[model samples]
Target: MLKNVSNQQIINVFKFLEAAWSTTQIRSISYEEKQKKQRTHAQKMIDMFDLPTKKKKFETRKPFDYSGDFGELEPLKDDETMFVYRGLEDKFKEFPQNYSKVTSLEYADGQEKMAHRIWTMQEKFLNICKYGERSEMIIAQKTIQIRNLKEHCQKNKKDTLARVILLEQIQGRKKELKKLRKRDYKRFIWLLKELDLLYRPHPLYVDLNTRRARMRQYLREETCRIIREKINAVYTRLDSEKENFYTEKEKVLSEIRKDLSDHNISAYDVLQNVRKLRQERVVERQNKAPPTPNTYRWIQSDKDRKKAERRERDLHRNALVKKGMQKLAQSEEAS
Candidate 1:
């Protein structure tokens, strides 16, 4: 039954059991550590007499069933082969046993007692073997499927290693995308907006036309929104702490006042200064030499202007002809 089970499966089982046992022990130790106080006499005595502590005798090593030099065997392609071999070698090196010796007993009905004991021993051994075989069968089946999958991946254009690397990268990107979407989405949008504005003429450098005025309005709204958010965060932090609430509020107000003063503006008269700044920027822009004209653009503008003049002349000529025709008809009717 054990022949069907791969070395890797056995090693994996042992490793899992070891890890789980270690974790249990760690949790138990942590709980005890949190107590801080010393253990009671009864608890200490119980720990001393625990089955794990009492069982100390090393088990005898079993001889390997196969009698071949492992070194002579070809190296396995799978990365887990060496790990499995080491794990199995370590496990078989020393096995613990609970009892050192077995006790014999005598009975009045000797033949019947001996027969019953033999039957019971055979039954126990069979049952143990049956369970072991069942476990081995399950592990062997799983190992076969895993080997098939590995073989399939190896045969395909995209091997397991490449697939694993790709999957890892995709997972990492997904996490980054999730963070961007959740926390930095607004900032990301704002950055895109700024990039778009970079390609266009700046409102301060251009005449305050309808479009420039609208852009300036948008910028002002964004600035106000940022300031309001900052003020709200400060308020929230202050509100959370009950001590010196009034004092904190006053300090926040003083900071705001100082910021406004630095900008040469007052809180109540902010709009006036903002408008003045806009006018000053527009004047500065107007004072600068105009941009050099593009030759092609200038030619296109001249053509458009001539077309408009021609259309106006045609309309005027048509109106004069209509008036002359109307006056002739009235003169004919009067004659």
Candidate 2:
């Protein structure tokens, strides 16, 4: 993301570059001074970008991040229908989430098959396709949804939590005497898997995926696409807001740098210098290690697992928050 600046500044830089490159008249600029002039030009653009300077101010939390996956962005296309089905194959998993706005893969065989949309191209129409119908401004896509998954365990009276309590009463004999018939082994395996908590997908998602597609599959895809667009709009708005904030901040940063001029770094110059210092150093690997065989290790203690998980979650959250805050602050300032 760009640091900050205004639309006007952007215009000047663009115009300067155009003029400089046009017909090689080159504005009679010196070769040695070219880089310095470019820097000044860019800084002017940044400083001139109009940003908000009101009571709303910069934000400390709730910044934005890249969300390309959510948008169904993919590599360059194969053949047209091939690209379409590839999209379907690629995003069948997402259909259950009601996520992607573009699905060329015809989705027939119910929403349950959203896990793997199988299409048979013959004289017969293969499957329900997720297509789009574009209007003047909107492209409507199909949407698939699961009705409901979470009914209270209290109402059902047969929850895992209850079963766990019962197992505890039997005194840690988790490998209990199920003693089912050999013929019913598969059923027992299903029951066992259903009983496991961590292994399961979210109940709501599972419910949605398991259900049949009530609406046309293409309609579902189109709906998902629309929703995806809405989500994108929200993020784009946030970006614009942040852009405005950063543009506003250039002047403030410049002012602060002016106050510290005795330190030998002008605001823009110091910033550019900071950018220079932040460049990554090329590293050469010296310690080459051989691949090790996988070993079956026992699980860590619950406390240790919990601590590690907590730490991981905390770090991830902190990273996200920090990024968002910085973006939000700069955007607000630039605006």
Output the number of the TM-score-best candidate.
Answer: 2
TM-score for each predicted model, relative to the true structure: 0.15, 0.18
- What is the C-alpha lDDT profile of model 1 across 1-335, one tens digit per residue? 99999999999999999999888784445767656444565356446543122435897743221111111112223222122133354454354421111111221233333333334434444554454433223322222233333334446755757446544533443344344445656643453242221112124665555634655666678789999999999999878775687778999989988998898886767778888999999999999998997879978999999999999999999999999999999999999
Q: Write the per-residue lDDT of candidate 2 for residues 76-183, one digit (tens) a residue.
A: 222223333454665466566333323432332333232222122211121222232111001101110110111222345657774444334222221221332233
Model 2 scores a C-alpha lDDT of: 0.44
Poorly placed runs, candidate 1 (over 4 Å): 1-294
- TM match of model 1 to true structure: 0.15
List ranges where model 2 is wrong by over 4 Å.
1-214, 239-243, 266-281, 284-335
Best by lDDT: 1
lDDT of each: 0.51, 0.44
